[model samples]
Target: MRYRRFGKTEMLLSVFSLGAMRYLESAANAEKTIWHALEVGINHIETAQGYGKSEEFIGQAMRNGLSKQRDRFYLTTKIGPTKDADSMRRQIEQSLKKMNVDYVDNFDIHGINLYEHLDLVKDPNGCMKAVREAIDQKMLGHVGFSTHGSLEVILDTIRTGLFESVNLHYYYFNQRNAPAVQLAHEKDMGVFIISPSDKGGMLYNPSEELSGVCYPYTALYMCDRFLLSDPRVHTLSLGAANPSEVDSHQDAWDNDAPMSELEAAVLDCMNRRYTLLENDRCSQCYQCLPCPEGINIPEVLRLRNLAIGFDMVEFGKYRYKMFENAGHWFPGNKAIRCTDCGDCLPRCPENLEIPRLLRDTHDRLHGEEGRRLWE
Candidate 1:
């Protein structure tokens, strides 16, 4: 496993940190996965209060001989934003007790997905105050946050200078957060890429076209290498469900050689796929934004791009339904909201039939509504 200096925290964290969210529905599997991760050199384990039963399962593992390896790993947990310091303080204590740990290496204010959430944490008597008190009491090491907010909101949060790290979405399929990652790096804040596999266009079950494009390297390995190639990125969270699942996260190469010739070829192929005019791709330019109806045109079209260009209909439906259901964590109405306003039509460099494509996207990808995993 390769390790990186996790920004200003000064901890050398494995590039493949274990995410304790999925496949942790039971204590036994949780213990098995945790042990396997530690044996395989993953030194960081991150969980959150909203990730049902995860903390309890971790505590159970610790009590079942895993505690003997305490010093061998770093523990991190998160609490949702609360309006008051007392509530935040209670959640912190609960997390510590549930995890069977005296101190968490990192404690994040989870899901600062809206401007109001940022305000809540920054309030003098709100969550950050309690987090600071925890640090002073020696129960928390570094403060951070996870987000699914807009680029504007993310940039605002990073400028606060209150966090030592950030966990957010950034991967090969979606580069919207690239600027935020760069900003975090500039501020010397640890950049933890959240859900790189699943939220990253469900690469675990990649479409045959995408898999072929990443040939010689599987989509999962290619995505991992793509993110790790950036010196600014500290780690990619792997939500492994079982011991066997951990093996897939192993690096394709042992050294820090960014973008080897083979990897570059794959990237070139992916770029060609993304830009194929025959696919009616959206190009992901921001010109179609500020929708009067609050629709996120680029995101909707990006999902459409995946569906049409790479046979990723399942991934499209999965994300499309997240519209309106996930709050600011995934703020946007479905493409069905497009009123055929000619505003975005003239601006699109691709001259994509904005309203028509949006309606088509909705028709193709709309399905059973998706609830945010933590919700």
Candidate 2:
């Protein structure tokens, strides 16, 4: 497996890291997957307190024997928006309890999306102070933040130069955060790409149109290669469902076979197809947020494109359910609760017709009975 310097740290992590989001439902399954990952040389395992049961499962799995391999891996977790410094400290203590670890290799402030959040962290009594105190106490080896926001927030966070690492959404399908990744590299901070495959549901079977455009390379391998091809990406965290998923990725890593001329041609064709798909129209800036309804606008658009491009009916159905079920989690304004305000159009980075796309998603998925299983 190819290894890269994990930011300014001396540790060299595998190009592919294991993400524990999908392991919330089953401990046995999670353990098997984690074991398989370790067996395959994936030394970086990422989890978050926001993801239910993931930390606890990792702790249990390690206690069952995986702990012996602890030194072989790099462990990371995150702290969410704590109400106050006392609460933040308590949460960190709880996280340690759940993970059964005295200290984590890396700890980050979860979801630093808005500019104001920076102020909150830098506040004397805010979570950032708590994080610093934790590090001073040797409770954390390194400190960082994760974001799903605009370039402005990303650049601002990087400029602080306070973090040893930064985790952000980045993938071949969504190069919106590429600049952030580059900035992280320039600042000598570890750059972690979260859920690259699952972003916009890119790794699933491609739509017919997308398949027609990206034929021989198979959407999965193409997506993996696209991310791995970039040297700036220190690691691509994959939410593998089973041992087989790990094995499939292992194939990509182990293969000594060079990209054939045909493969290169296919990739070029896919890139061109993506270019035409967006038409340079939507920058995916996501400024018109807080949809009155819980719609995850960017995510919906991405899944819709995946549905149309790949022609995967089941995948489309799944995406629809995710939106409908998780609808309540987002602020009412940021979701399907949107009013017919054309106000968001001007603020958009890509200048997309936001209302129109929102309407399209509702009409297409809401009518399908199979898609409403979440309801």
Candidate 3:
């Protein structure tokens, strides 16, 4: 695996890092998978307090035999924002004990996905103070944050200049975070892309139309190549569930040349998708926001884009179902919340019928309520 300097942290990290959230099968399997990732040169291992059994799996792997090779990889774990320093410090200690490690290479304030979450972390006697104390005690190294927040919130978090790195979403399917990525790079912060294959439009099970659009490359590889092509993106978390999945991502390691052809492929896919649907003109301008019912208009329309233009009906319904449960991570209600309010009608540069399209989006992608991955 190729390595890059992880911004201000200065750690040379593998372009592909193993995310341990999906490592819930078995301790033996986790060991095998982690061993395979190390064999393939992946040196960054990330887990979280909320990912069920994830920390235990890594700890088991270490105690079972991998302890001797601990220094070969950098370890990272995260905790959700806490209201007080004492509770946050306790959680940090618990994470260390669970991982069978004295110190972690990085500790991120997890899921700062809301304004209130940020407030909790930045509170004088809250998680930030606890993290600083951990750093001073030699229990944590670089301090960072992982977020699923809005663009405004993300930019604000970066501007705080408190974090050494940031783990956020930026993939082929959703480039809304591009500005935030650029800002992070300018601030010399490590930029980690989260769940590129799964959250990045469920590329693991690409729709037939989507697959055809990315002709000459599998959706997974295409998406991987697209993200790594950008210098600002430091690493991508491969949420591999097994040993074989690690091998599948190795091909992206080759060819460090310009991606002119890949760029053309993306442009072609974007242009052709507009022809596939009637109201394909949302443009995601974001001017028609602050909806009276708090519906995420652009996201709902983007789901509509994927469902109709790319035949990603299942993926659409899956994400659409998370509207209510995802909270600030993916805020807003279903498009059905539109009350035919003309408030957003004039703001749309596309001049599209706002209420009608929202209802249509709801009709196309609505399904049973779904839970967030960590929930």
Candidate 4:
């Protein structure tokens, strides 16, 4: 695989890093799968304590002679934004023991996904302090964070200069995080793109229309190359569930010279198709903010686009329910809490009927039936 200088960390991060978030094989097979990645020169491994069995699987694979040369590659496992220093400290120890590593090359403050979550992480006596202590003791070489949060919050976390790298979402479908990627570059922080296929509009199960739009290339390959083509994006996570799935994303490596032609053709088709449903739908512009009841208008509207524009009702419904648990990170009351105040009407450049769309969203995507789908 090709490599990029991962900002401040100075690691030659592989363009296609193995994301160990999905593994469905037996221990022996899991070892073989991880071994194959190493055999193919995948040197960066990203996993999390929360990803069930992932860290343990990697540990077991290493113990079974997957590789004895730990010094050659970078390993990162996430731990906190824990509620307290002690809990976060114990988590670090637990992660080390479970992975059977004396030290990690890098560490992550897992899931600082909102403003308040950032506050919790930076708490003087909380996770931030605990990790610094771990670093001082050489338990980990450096510290960073991962987020499924807004660009604003992600930038806030990067600005602190406490982290050496960052993991955030940025892809073809969601360029909203572009500014965060830029700011991280400015700060010289490593930027790792998370879940390009799964969170990037579920490219694995592309719609028939999407398949046609990204013709000659699977929508997945199109999306991977789209992000890889950009100089600012350091690496894209290839979260392969099975070993065989690895080869597809790797083709994007060093094949960027053809990306300009491919992106123009594919994007024109996709933009034209998606534009058909844009008349009254929200542009996810985030202009209509500070709604008195604290509604996340842009996100709700984006979900609406999935259902209306792409006929992806099932996926739309699944993500809409996430707001119920995501708290202030996703923030705002559901569409039902709009209260018809029209406070957001003037702020919207589209001058669309803000409350009316929220009502439509509430009626269509949110309800007891949809809640059960995710619950």
User: lDDT of each prediction vs. the true structure?
Assistant: 0.88, 0.72, 0.87, 0.79
Give the better candidate number (2 or 4) by TM-score: 4
Estimate, for each residue in 1-375, the C-alpha lDDT of model 4 and write its tens digit.
778888888988888778887764566656666767777777888998887788888888778765487866788999758878888889999998888888888899988887878898778887788888998999988788998777778888888888988998887777888898889888888889988887777777877767777888888888888887777778888787777877767667766453676677877776666675666767777878877887788888877776676665655666676666655435556888888988899898888888888888877887543221112
Residue pairs with backbone overlap in model 1: none
The residue ranges of model 3 lying beyond 4 angstroms of the native Cα positions read none
Off by over 4 Å in 1: 253-255, 346-349
lDDT of 2 by residue, 1-375 (tens): 878888786569888889887766688999999988888889988888888789999989878988888799988898765647888899999998998888888888887777667777767787777888988999888888887666778889889887888888876666777788888989888888887666534565556676677676667777677667667767888788777778666646653245668767878886555454463234456676645454567665664554444454455555555544343222122234557677776778776777777666565554333321112
Ordered by lDDT, highest first, the candidates read 1, 3, 4, 2
TM-score of each: 0.96, 0.82, 0.96, 0.89
Q: Write the per-residue lDDT of candidate 1 for residues 83-149, one digit (tens) a residue.
A: 9999999989998899888899888889999899999977988888999999999999999999988
Question: Where does candidate 2 have its weakest 10-residue lDDT segment?
Answer: 326-335
Candidate 3 lDDT by residue in tens digits, 167-207: 99988778899999999999999999998988888888888
Q: Give the runs in model 2 whose Cα sits over 4 Å from its true position.
A: 200-202, 208-212, 255-261, 274-358, 367-375
Superposed on all Cα atoms, model 1 deviates from the true structure by an RMSD in Å of: 1.6
301: Cα error in model 4, Å = 1.2
Question: What TM-score quantifies how close candidate 3 is to the native fold?
Answer: 0.96
